[model samples]
Target: MNYFKKLLLILIVLGAKLPLIAQVKLPALVGDNMVLQQNSKVNLWGWASPNEKINIQLGWQTAPVVITANPDGTWKTAVDTPKGNEKAYDITIDASNKIILHNVLIGEVWICSGQSNMYFPVGKEEGTWKTGVVNYEEEIKNANFPNIRIFTVLTKASQKPLDDVTGSWKECSPASVKSFSAVGYFFGRNLYQKLNVPIGLIASSWGGTKAEAWTSEKVLEENTDFLPILENDAKNEKLYQEKLEAYYSDLKKERIANNNDLSKSQLKKPKKEDNKTSYVLYNAMLNPLVNYTMKGVIWYQGESNAEQAYLYRSLFPAMVKNWRNDWNQGDFPFYFVQIAPHKGQNPDIREAQLISSKSIANSGMVVTTDVGDANNIHPIDKQTVGYRLSLLARAKTYNEPNLVFSGPIYNNMKIKKNRAQLFFDYAESGLVKNGDVLKEFEIAGEDKVFYPADAKIEGKTVVVSSEKVKSPVAVRFAWKAIPEPNLFNKEKLPASPFRTDDW
Candidate 1:
């Protein structure tokens, strides 16, 4: 072939590839069958050719929104979404190439995140440990909510923030919901039924992962208490590298000794630090979806952080603040499930969650005292968990007036002779004990030695007295691990475990 002809053919091939490289692309959350946050200015972003003019057309709106791509080929703009309805919409983007998203709904979009409980699936999958929620077959058979959409972010861990994630939105069905987060699916299902609007749920979770793994590095660096997390990460990484080197060295020696006749099953490679490593889950799983608009977040984690329960008092709220700040949404509702009763999870972890729910603005906690199993860490009663979370969103977020969503929260205690009269915040309609008598109530004198007390509902307060605890200085309810407290308000929500004294 002639030199001139070869040069011309190369130019033609390069020109064809240029068009493909410069084409517009979008994040996984902004694709087909997705739901946008309702009645708000929702952000839409993507990448195109540098300085290219991008036009976005919403199905409900007449005028097209125009934006120019930045030098790095990134473009972002906000468009107002109307109130949620049953109608499905379409979104079109025009840049170097055209892209269209179909079956887009405007509604309440929620980010469902946490550790294993939130990662629990609706139905069991083969060759996996997720044994499914309670009544796996029936739940899967009944799962047919088309208006509810779910997006499960594939599990990933990154050392730095990522721009995109690997997953796609799917309408809820028996097939799709099988692998979806059971808590997330039930939560969205409740919202769809209550609000009568399309519900979007984004499930970004990792099982057996710590809260620090889902928090940003910058947020952890700001607090000295969280410094230990970063320090431990450094040490684990170093140890992992050493172990990986030793494994390879041993493998090479064994291979030479056997004349490369080794079976793969005979050896195990050094496992890398997984989702437990600090800040990695947030960088890969949560960071990619921050720009996408949502109503709030629902979390069901904390089992892994039980060992450092005191530090979690600070870490939990800081992580909430970190997310709110990153989303630039002012104090959006952040509802979470308190750790259920189990031998591994101590009472102090639940106390830390209680403190965080009170400290963080626009936050709520769902007490699982009534639903927890002492032997089971992943409690099977996710329906109660999801339903309680929806109640908070209904009353607080959706402004369902006069609806009681929370269980009795401890307010104060007064001493009347040898009896301690306990006051509560959510017991306006009065308290009710499910059992013959209130269980888990204890009173302590100056020595702080708590003894079981006889507790009775006295209108909106509980009066507890123990002959052993004369002149009581403090009172506690459900203060031990695996406590089955019978205390509740009229609404049937279980009272959160609480103590009057720090000690």
Candidate 2:
């Protein structure tokens, strides 16, 4: 070929490749069908060539935001979002190459996170063990809310923090909602129906994971009680390496013994690292999402931590604080579900959750004593759970007055002769037993020995007395692995289990 012809070809190739390298790049979340927090300055970040000038044009506004990339090729800027509306907007980014994000919405965005129950989908699969939520068929068919959107972070674990996650915003439809988080969907649906605004739910969860896996290492290190989590994780990593080495060695020997027939060998490979390892999920899943603005969070977990339920009293609150600090959003609402009645779940976990709800400010808890099943770990009635969470958000976050969002919480106990009078906080209209008589009440004397007590409701308080204990010093109600407490407030919300004594 001629020299002039070869030079032209090289120039053409370089022109095409240059734009590919220098063009702006966005995170998975800052893409099409994304929802930015309404009435707030939402952060938008991306990478580009060093010192490159970028122009961002919001469809709702006329003035374009102009910024320059840093030396490290990272750039972030805040843009104001209007109030929630049905009008669709577009975001245009102009730099080395133009990129347009279409169909953006401004509304309430919530982060839905936790373990398996939070990860449960709305529709059942054919081969999997997931039986789906109650009335799954009808629910899935009616899930056609165009204003509600969901972004599900794929399961990932890392030893170090990540820059971005793997997910995309999808419009809520029968096809899209089936695989999305059921609790997240229902919660968003309720919010959309009540507030009549665009609702965005980001589901970042994994089944059978622990709170330590979702908590940051800095927060865990601050407390001496959480030091064991880091120590145990180091030990587990070492053990995994040792097991992997042995497995490879055994597999090599098996392959040789089978005349080099790889198919005949039955040696199984060792797993790399557990998803339940400390801070792995936070590094991979949650860290990548810190830049995105959200209204609040909804969590459902604690089954795995039941063994060390005592530690969860501190661990759960620390985890919430870590996220709040990282997000830099001042004390945003964080609502969670109390671990329900199950044969394998300890009652201490529920108590720890109840304590956390009181300890943490702007936090709410949904009690599921009435909806729990003794044999099933994952409850089927997610609609009620989601609706109750939405009620808390409506009453507390959205400032809807005169709404009963919580069940009755035990306040203080007073001893009157041979009986103990139990007062509660949310029994404004008085308490009522669902059955003929109230059960699960027990009275303890000075010896700390508790016996079944006869309980009767008077006004907003319940009086308990036991013939076995003449002098009642304390009282405990629904203190068991699986309890069927019939107590409820006039709002039909069940009362959380409580004990006057620490023991």
Candidate 3:
């Protein structure tokens, strides 16, 4: 019972304290300053000591979910989120430590996906690549709406499927907006502004990925022509990994070999063995986030698949169906960005995108034909792109009547003795041709040769005829790649690109 006994007790206490203070394991995706999908039940998960009881208290003013840590030291529980309003909340666990999540909100959460266009976020001032940094700065700084949050899935490709991912959710503001998907941020921003609802966006995208990569293997298997992707994966167990390794090895070597730094070598390769093959990206990026809830998907891909535009007739629709089945959302409204006015594509892929939207159930397509810069695939002017997408959602998904969602979409065509009559879906003021007259229509006879048609709007229908062709068998509108297709609704929304005849 002396001073020596007291000193020994203190030493023992300090030894236990060191490890406890260091004991922190957070899921990479769940970290400080991250956005969580709102209005839906969210899963906040992490790991701790084996069999240790854990409690996650979330909300500025409510009850917290409590649970006992599992045998493996991992735990997860769902917390219901509130509508958009920035409010910081404290999460205390085990009466010892607490984590604070600031500026959280509950609202509509959308998965912004597809290829590089969707991932483009480099510029804000010029808009291309979100060049204007100040726009993002102002946006993130005043991100007071606790309702808007964003989560970005880091780009990764796997030869094999992965079950979980590492990322974090943070409230949307200027600081958060910088790293957010430029296209997605603009899209959600437009929707949030219009609807006054909380907005949550999950950015899961890869540059230069094919539509096939977004489709699930099982879903791809449903199509007779697309099943080969899965068969190949099964036959060559290591094909994906080995192929990716070789690709990266070559890519890295090239960067060093060229040393040009400005070589424009496409920088990277797809994450899977077959970058162009179907469902490779789905297995990794998408599959992991399927558990999150929300509205629909906004796609901005197809450049990599441009050469296969003809095949996309089936591939694109299959991708949509696969996602619908995966999400179990039963034909949840899907809207896509038609491939923009990129020069090399010659406008072929845009038509395919239009077809995918029109031919599918509960789907829509936004026309980027009028918005993109031909030289650069990454275009600015995203403000309108997002606004157009919102119009579609507001009209179709939310059933907001009296809302003009799109430009003219081909509704039906009737062939007269010498002319084809085209009926269109939208044109608030009745189809007024842009400028002098309606441009971008073509008529092809049985020989399958097509010539420009002199088309004019007459009482909501456009009658078309080409002096170069007689007895036309099919009518084509906006069929050419980057065709200066000018048809639009009174609302100024461009008509979706289209080609009537397969030939």
Candidate 4:
């Protein structure tokens, strides 16, 4: 090289080794056509040069908010948003560089997250239900809710919590809404209709993911019961590379024996990163959106943890509490859909979920016992699920008066001689047998051997008795994996399965 060119190469090599100074950069979430929580302090955050001053000018606000980036290049500020959606707004962030976000709306924002059931979209897709829902065509054809926006988090797994995620907000249109979570779309659509305001749904979910996968590492380590999950993850981290190499070696041998060309796409995909590993999904997907202000969260997970239903009693609630703490939102509405009835599932998982809902503050559970298909775990009737969830939000969260949002919930059981009388909440309007006379009730004596019981709905309580058990000590209703119980409230909502005995 010439003298001047060699000097330039030397300078370039030194520059490559030096740290590149970062300019003002916002997360993909804080982009155009986004919706901020209305009537609340919404968190807006991004990265800038260390100790750089950031001035945020919102079109709605008269005065610009000033903040300073920390030594680590992270900056955050809360902006107050008004309730009405009279006009679109813009946000300009000036730091080392300038970034302007346009067409922002202020409204109710919610996070919809869970497993496969929550990840299922409105449109017909591969590897899910064979066909779309019964009304999928009509629903998608008429879906033109511009006021409702949705942002779906891209699936990722990480060993450590990430500071940002990859996603973008889009207006709910026919094309956009088809691939979005069906439950989330219906929930947002219902909210917009009832409140007459803009609605934003942030969906962060993964198929076949356990609750522990969405929990913080610290939270899992603190509990001794979750030690197994941590230990398994440690083992997975250690052996992942070895397993991947072995898988590729076996695939190569098999292809050679078959005299087939080794196509790159045909090669067996290595499981380098597992979505089921504990705390990875939360680190990559959820951690990045910790303080994005929202009204509440809706969850539809539990099937993955059903095998360890007993442990989930504590773990599920801990995960919720951890999320609430991380979001800095004080017990905002955490509504979840109860798992539908399916064969081969541990019934205890449903019981555990119900307990968690009651234990957690400002939480509601939507019973889906009636709408489930016994054969398919992923039920296609997500419209009912979303509508039911909306009812809970409207009645409990939004203060809608006289709304019947719940079915019969166990209150207290009264034992009179050999018969057990069941008292339930949400039966003020009286109970109604949906179809065949209230089946699936069982009565047991001190021996704890339960027998099929004949139940009679007397007023608001159901009196259950079995001739075989003269001294009934306990009673259970719809307490099986594939129960088809015919019990409901006057409002036509199905009753949640319950067991009076702890066993």
Residue 41 alpha-carbon offset, candidate 4, angstroms: 1.3
Q: lDDT by residue for model 3 over 1-503, one digit each (tens)?
A: 79999999999999888754324355555555445555556677666766666666676446667786677767777667765554544555552345554554555668899887788762353433536423555555665544567788887766566666757787666666766777787778777777777677888988778887888767677678776556655666567667778888888787788894636786566554445555668887887676555678887888988887877888989888778877665787788888777677855677777777778999888887778777777776666777788888888877888988888888888888889998888865677666988888889899998888999888878899988777988888776555677777777887776667766
Q: List residue ranges in candidate 1 displaced over 4 A.
A: 1-21, 127-130, 264-266
Collision count for each candidate, in order: 0, 0, 35, 0
Off by over 4 Å in 2: 1-21, 126-129
Itemize residue pairs with steric clashes in candidate 2: none
Task: TM-score winner between 2 and 4, please give it.
Answer: 2
lDDT of each: 0.92, 0.93, 0.73, 0.90
> In candidate 3, how many Å is residue 427 off?
2.9
Segments of candidate 4 deviating more than 4 angstroms: 1-21, 234-273
For candidate 1, lDDT tens digit of each residue in 1-503? 99999999999999888844588889889999999999999999988888889989999999999999998999889999999998999999987789999999989999999998998888877755456888988999999988899999999999999999999999999999999998998889998998999999999998889999999989999889989889998999899999889889999988898889787536788788588898899999989998999999999999999999999999999999899999998898999999999987788999999999889999999999989889888888888899999999999999998989999999999998999999999899989999798999989999989899999999999999999987999998999888989999999999999999998
Model 3 residue 342 CA deviation (Å) reads 2.5
By lDDT: ranked, best first: 2, 1, 4, 3
lDDT of 4 by residue, 1-503 (tens): 89999999999999999977789998978999899999988899988888889999999979999999999998888888888583789899987789999889988999999998998898898776556655998999989988898999999999899988889999999899888999999888998999988898999999999999999999999889899888877897778878788888888787787776565435665565578988888899999998799999999999988898999999999999999999888988999988999996867999998898899999999999989999999889999999999999999999999999999998899999988999999999999997667799999999999999999999999999988999998999888999998898999888889898997
Cα lDDT of model 2 by residue, 396-478, tens digit: 99998899998899999899899899999999988999999999999999899999999999999999998899999989989
Error of 4 at 157 (Å): 0.8
